[model samples]
Target: MIKVGITGQAGFMGNHLFNYLGTKSNDIELISYERDFFKNEKTLEAFVSSCDVIVHIAAMNRHEDPQVIYNTNVGLVNQLIDACEKTSSSPKIIFSSSTQEDQDNLYGKSKRDGRKALEKWAIESNGEVVSFIIPNVFGPFGKPFYNSVIATFCHQVVSGEEPNIHSDGTVNLIYVNELSAAFYSEIISNKNKSTIKMIPFTSTKKVSEILNLITSFKVDYIENGVVPNVSRDSFELNLFNTFTSFIPKKHFPKKYIKHEDDRGAFVEIMRALTSGQSSYSTTVPGITRGNHYHTRKIERFAVISGKASIKWRKINTDEVFEFILDGKEPAYVDMPIWFTHNITNIGDEELITLFWINEPYDQEDSDTYFEEV
Candidate 1:
């Protein structure tokens, strides 16, 4: 079995890599080097010797001291190379570098130098290295208030704080899952390279566009039962999923505004994409609800309170079906796709019923035809 070692396994991309590799890592032995790995000298050497592949994910990117960032980043490569050499092992090294290597800043120069150093060591010692200059990566479980804008925005908005945007410049984004897949491929495919650029399948969006979409998703989905139009595009859905992951458990079961008067109250209950929607309504005595047939949407009707009679009929058939049910029974009847159906209050009390549909309501193509049963 091939052994793979990951440094900084708890960090964002590192942890994501560990998880994605689990899908097809059955033949590979996995090792992790946390923050304390460098402190213990013997363990670092032994870990390098034990692995057939090493993913170097540890680095100081966001630091107050420029000198520290430069020194730590450059020193990290030297230490990794020295440890592997001391063990007399040529384990393939996967170094996670940043795209800032092209810039003239301190962080950029240090990363560029580190890449050069890795290349030099690989040539002189006849070792294998995969140095990847990756783009901005963001996904689930990323730390908020750190380097990830998506994570921080999700956290601040969930916490009722405004997102702080210094500029509305467009930002390139690559999901952590995509990067993790790249890591797995390098480890398993045995690809040796001097410098690898992970520029595949990145999405670009303006800062304002991102924040506005996420904000609209929050207001429309959480406050109201309306599912945001995340189905319109790929990035919208990704952003919505990321935003929902940060929502605290206490935020669930949120109440919505109900339009009520002397008649009764009406409100949208819940919505989903493929699984459909759920809603409830109350009807006075002798009041009948729903006289419609849907061509495609599968529906369910349950008598939640009082006594009710649910009736249905095929569009062009003389046969009519009726089900007498009460709240005490607590049973639901699934409505067929093309059946015209309705429910009526047959008792001397308010009849409450819950409804579920297989798809959210669409005005343009409602798939609903009006008919009386």
Candidate 2:
């Protein structure tokens, strides 16, 4: 197995990449990294010597003084190089640069200079370096104000705060999961050459266009409890998923309205503007139904009969969210991407659940990963 470590394992992109790599434990052994390591030479050297590959992702993105950003970023690159040289380590280094390298700003200049320094170190130490010029990245769990504009907008919309657009210029974007997969592929490729690769943007949109789309999701999904028309593999679908991730955990287990008549009672299980497949299952008491999660598909579990407890825990996290539902008061809980979830029959009678997903199951590319909640 390849031993890989990430410098900024706690940052937005770093955390996503770290967790994505965690899913491939059979092939890659992740080396733990803490921010404090950079302050200590011995610890940093130990980290450098232990890794087969190191991804340098930690950098100061914003500060009141632009020079501080430049100094901090370049200083990080220097420290990493120093640690490598001190330990006589030649581990392959994957550097994360930004598209802002061409802009007339300190952040851009820092990325440019940092990449050049790494390139110099690779040449002198006979080490491998892959410097990626990445575009704007967005995804779930991103910091509202610090990560990206998309994250800020999603948070604002979800929290009932009005979104403001400073500029309507077009933006090239890549989802965090997509970028993580690219990084993983590179780590496994084992190419023993130093090179610079441009990570292409997967989607492009005007600032206004993105805001409008997210606002529409707030109206449809958040307010009306209706899933908007979204197709699998579409950028809209990814954006919708990102928007939903910002929702407060307390908003879930949404109760459905039940209509009662002389004969019986009826309740709508789901309302969507897209096509999907619906299935139901009967689970015996004391049995659990699911311990899997989907990466792209939107799924929901509605308790139609008996009492059930649904649990969810995002990958690489200890916090687990749970909701209880009964047949008498119909309710549903939607599963978010990258979260392992399960439903248990907590009652005496058989548990009946109605399942709805945005797409039909395909064995060839199910996108399902099994994990305990």
Name the regions of candidate 1 deviating beyond 4 angstroms.
231-233, 253-269, 273-373
> Would you list the clashing residue pairs of candidate 1?
none
TM-score of 2: 0.97
User: Which candidate comes out best when scored by TM-score?
Assistant: 2
lDDT tens digits, residue span 1-373, model 2: 9999999999999998998888788999999999999999999999999999999999999999999999999999999999999999999999999999999999999999999999999999999999999999998888988999999999998888998888799999999989999999889986799999999999999999999999999999989899999998888999999999999889889999999999999898899999999999999999998898877889999998999999999987899999999988989999998899999999999989999999999998888889999
Residue 52 Cα positional deviation in candidate 2, in Å, after optimal superposition: 1.3
- Candidate 1 structure quality by residue, lDDT tens digits, 311-344: 8785545788788877754545656534688899
Candidate lDDT (C-alpha), each? 0.75, 0.94
Question: Which ranges in model 2 have alpha carbons more than 4 Å from their true place?
Answer: none
Give me candidate 1's TM-score against the actual structure: 0.69
Q: Model 1 — which ten-residue stretch has the worst lDDT?
A: 249-258
